[model samples]
Target: MAKEKKYESELLITRIFSAPRELVWKAWTEPERVMRWWGPKYFTSPICKIDFRVGGSYHFCMQSPEGEDFWSTGVYLEIIPLEKIVCTDSFADENGNVVPATYYDMEEDFPLELELTITFEDHNGNTKMVLQHIGIPEGITQELTKQGWNESFDKLAEILE
Candidate 1:
């Protein structure tokens, strides 16, 4: 008998939005819509470009309250319209070139590439979205990522309203 492999994931976040699943999906895949709510509180995405197909990429800059800019880029690995999205996310420059997590000068080691999977399901007339992020290193705390997601989702909800 073959032994089963237990897959370990670092973070999981779930949000139930008061909107249709398709609308929620649009908010994630459309650049115009994403600009409205892609960052956390006090952070604005001044630049966003999304080519939302398999192997396509999305890049954006999240501006801090103090006017500092941080960039993130992702390449889509799978996309199921209105249902699921899987992508590899990484810190990057304005040109979308990969950057090491050490650039952030954090104490812990944050993985340069992290796989994020999101699924959208219909909850009656609303939408239930689940986001799972894998490959976070042990030295890095999950709270930081969780807080960022929670804050970003709060912004997303406002746009969905």
Candidate 2:
């Protein structure tokens, strides 16, 4: 049999915060904390909701510096407390209804749904978080996602501090 093909994510966001694993997980799972650092620089997350369990859902809205609003929703596929989280992320309306990727210009080649696998590891007393986004084509989504995550992580670090 031919070797099974694997889905290699072209976009990955990794950050190690000077905080405990549990605290790092809380920053991701807690809507209130997520609202503090969930968008790119100059962007703000005015709304954030997280169920934070297997099969549960999360939704949030990010307002751009230009005042345009963008919403994103996700369903948790797997969760291991402070260890790992797998979820499906997509553009959505305020009602949490999934919309076309093109609606947000998130992707041009890949499907609307993006798979995100986030892992948190304890590095001494700090937390190492890795966010791997699967199905990110070589386009705007990749750059925008990276920029957003990086900005978010910076905010998270400040929060942890």
Candidate 3:
């Protein structure tokens, strides 16, 4: 009999922005603006392919400071224009095909994929953005992912400004 491994992990981030919900939504839907704040600081994302409707896909390449580039692609499960978006994200090769095996952040067993749900709400004149990440591998990897997302949102706010 084979032993069954247990998997557990989740991340949630809530942010209140001083911008309207519509503008915030546009930043996410528009490719040019999204590229400006899609990844971590010092990492520039120059390549972006966005299809804002349901069942569409968003793909991009993030270039690190040392000229190393990483490719990430995701398929939009749901998109409620100005309200919410749900997608499944994964690390991919140059042809956008998911690699059969990969090491992430030095964790050989870490899951290279995650499901993300992003919600935007209007709070008076301010916008509240809630991001929920599920299915990430456990331990330090999850924590690192949360921090990375927070930093990305911080960058998003700056771009919105």
User: Each model's C-alpha lDDT?
Assistant: 0.84, 0.84, 0.79
Model 2 regions more than 4 Å off: 1-8, 105-110
In candidate 3, which residue pairs get closer than 3 Å at backbone N, Cα or C atoms, i.e. clash?
Answer: none
List TM-score per model, in order.
0.90, 0.90, 0.88
Off by over 4 Å in 3: 1-7, 100-106
lDDT of 3 by residue, 1-161 (tens): 10122125678899998899998998888889888888787888888888878888888888888987788888899988788999878787666876532622455554556678999999978999998887666677778778777888889898777
- Residue 16 lDDT (model 2): 85
TM for candidate 3 is: 0.88
Per-residue lDDT value at 38 in model 2 = 87
lDDT of candidate 1 over 63-156, digit per residue (tens): 9899988899989999988899999888898889989766666543566778889999999789999999886544335777788889999999
Q: How far is candidate 1 from the true structure (C-alpha RMSD, Å)?
A: 4.0
TM-score top scorer: 1
Candidate 2 structure lDDT: 0.84
Better of 1 and 3 by lDDT: 1
